[model samples]
Target chain A: MKNGIWVSKNGRVSEASGLQPRDALLFAPHGMTSEDLLQEQRSALQQNIKLIRTRLAEATRR
Target chain B: MAKARVFISSVNEDGLKPLRRSVFRVLEGLGHEPLMWEENLGPWPSYQNPVEKCLEAVEQSDLYLLFIGTRGGTFDAAAGVTVTHSEFIRAVDKGKTVLVWADAETKAIFFSGIAWKLDEYIAHTVQESGSYPAPMQALDFLRSCQEAPPHIDPYVWLLLHDIRQRGIYVEDLARGVETDWRGYFSDLLRRGLLLLPLEPTIAENSNRLEEAETSFDLLAALLPQVTLEPPHDWKVWLNTIRERLQGRTIEHRYGRWNRETVGSYEACNAASLYRRDGDSMRFISCCGRASAVRSFALNDQSSYIALTYAMGPRAEQVYYTESGQKFFYCVRSGPFVATFHFPAGSSWDQLRYIRYKDSVVSAIIGPNTRLVKLVRLLLGGMRA
Candidate 1:
């Protein structure tokens, strides 16, 4: 989730990412909107899913 | 999108009605199940406690998505907190991923310290009242309880303060006005896999969905997956057992061992039973009723009847046993003792199913259901 813009296929305004209140959350640094932190989360998910996919591919090949 | 059972928690308030409805629609659209607080719960018998039903849902969910509105929910006399908060605490205690969402505008105002001014006004309007039944440790909502003037939403401020002060992160507390909640939640569901507690299936599902190039492909992959119904009775809550095992806290839950109660109890066939110790009862009692004798055990120190016994474990006790080459990772509900048998060569989740002396897969190492494995796999190993 660290770096990338995401556009939804179903189309709601993806341009302005959703920001939860900064003071209200943790792991959220100053000067970054909550969406930026959420982006890191999304990015991590993509990577993990890729890891699992790679593993699955290996398993199937075996 | 990853499938998940989200236990949607909220007080019944007009402000939140639309959010609940829309969230349900969004969850369904994303191929996830939304366990609504009301309506979607319960197939319980009349005598069963409603709290058990809600707790049951909380137990079954992959995520505890909580919505704290501008008011307190219905207070449960037995539990002492609002039903919603009790469930919230249970989710926290249970180690579930709790995404606490409050009214963003109200949270901002509370953070701004307008709550002090609001309380000052409320200080004048305060009427004589008895204490609110709440644990000071969960929150010192005691001050809010005593001082709140009518008309102002005191609970949300008290709530924001309580949740924040207690170190519970309120980061996800965003809502409608500035954000498209649908997009927000859709992104949340699609990306929520990273936040799941720990399940073995996350890897399996990611692989299954990896080449799912189309929505049709995704549906084709998911179609054979089994949907697990909530346990009927006496089935060991594997999540609870795993957590308690880690925490080293002993606990027991008693249920009548009968035909209707065998939701996932592996010894449903009643294949074998252990001989009772002279000190232990041939019949057992467990922790539920007082001075009540029974065909089954339902109280503390109640003897455990396994395999061939007519009544199933009235109390759950955890232990690991040896069965030749493969270690039987068994959990008995009445007492606690164990050995580390997860030889490095074994995967904990795959080693979860155990074999009894009779060579049948018996009670609790974990359910041997294909549905359990499939759901866990598809769910991105949310909890193993």
Candidate 2:
């Protein structure tokens, strides 16, 4: 059987059947592709950066 | 005149202590009678009919003050019929003046409840600065009302008076002005007019009518601007709202994915831009374990989008983004797939630019991997 991943409805991640433990270990089951995860992380990081910049601007104004 | 009666309703016992005391003191100071369930109820009545008495108190009161706490009981919980909820309903049913106050914490908790959620009461819930003791907040609400001159309920009165003052007459109000002109004229009638023993001549009535007409003209010009401007330019409208709400001291932040992120060459390589139009943009991005897709409009009006994954669980949020942008994203647990949708009024060229960026990122990560090939095909279709 092809090794796959499974993500539970509540966002829990689990490995699918037939994959090697190593490959399974590398994969996450929450149904998010690796690319999607990276993009979301980047989006969050950018938001944090904006927040920090806004805070700094406010501090400087004060 | 008889003292005004007030009913106070709250969910939290611990938080109610100080607020209860403060409300009691303030109302007493203002020569009013203040009633609270915990302080005034002799005991939870054995008879179910006791609820009727509570409703009666609410009906008799000049004002009903609802104190919404951060936590009390679930709406679906057996204790869901909280005093606050009951009093609110009773006050509404009886057509009493009801005031509602809640803080952010309470709002979150209140909204989460299944039974009587905050959204059900949003029209009545007045957002306060923070979770102060309920009684003190109640005192503040009372004092604010006292400071304002006796007028019709502010929101209603403002709408009615402003609409009349602006000269833009609704058919209903125009009829009211014609039939029982006395009822409409009473508000404009001054104390000076009443003091005269003799009835005013036609000239005096004409003068008053002219004054009202001028007032209406000023209101018609200004009120519509106040009502209409915000929907046209939402960004400026939101900023104005934020400014007015600064005293509430709650941070309201909204963010949008800019062209650099959405239209990057890297993004195009990783995602597929499925649809492009003047106001709508749609695309899908995929990686090893997950995929995300969405549709949104440039003008940020009503739009919906969804993403599902091959491996991981999917989640969805439907919300409007800053700058009138709206979209949705979903991801798989292991591989990466992301999709975006822009609606009929959005800038499709901007989406194309984002697809281009994603393509660049795919090239950098893996020159000709299967995932990269898939991304290339997706972007190539967009170009075609």
CAPRI grade, predicted model 1:
incorrect
Which whole-number lDDT from 0 to 100 does residue B162 have in model 2?
Answer: 21
Per candidate, native contacts kept equal 0.04, 0.00
Residue B40, candidate 2: C-alpha displacement in angstroms: 2.9
State each model's C-alpha RMSD to the native: 24.5, 23.6
Cα lDDT tens digits, model 1, B202-314, are: 66566555554345345536744654343333123333223332111111111111011111222111111122334332322211111223333322222223221222322
| Per-residue lDDT over B151-249 for candidate 2, one digit per residue giving the tens place of the 0 to 100 score | 222222222222222222232211112233234224323542454333334335545655764674475355434322113432332233222211111
The candidate scoring highest on lDDT is: 1
Local lDDT at B147 for model 2: 29
Most TM-score-accurate candidate: 1
Q: What lDDT does candidate 1 reach at residue B292? A: 22
Instruction: Name model 2 segments beyond 4 Å from true.
Output: A1-62, B74-81, B108-384
- TM-score result, candidate 1: 0.37
Model 1: DockQ vs. true structure: 0.03
| Candidate 1: tens digits of C-alpha lDDT, residues A1-62 | 22222221221212214432221111100233222433464466577777555545533442
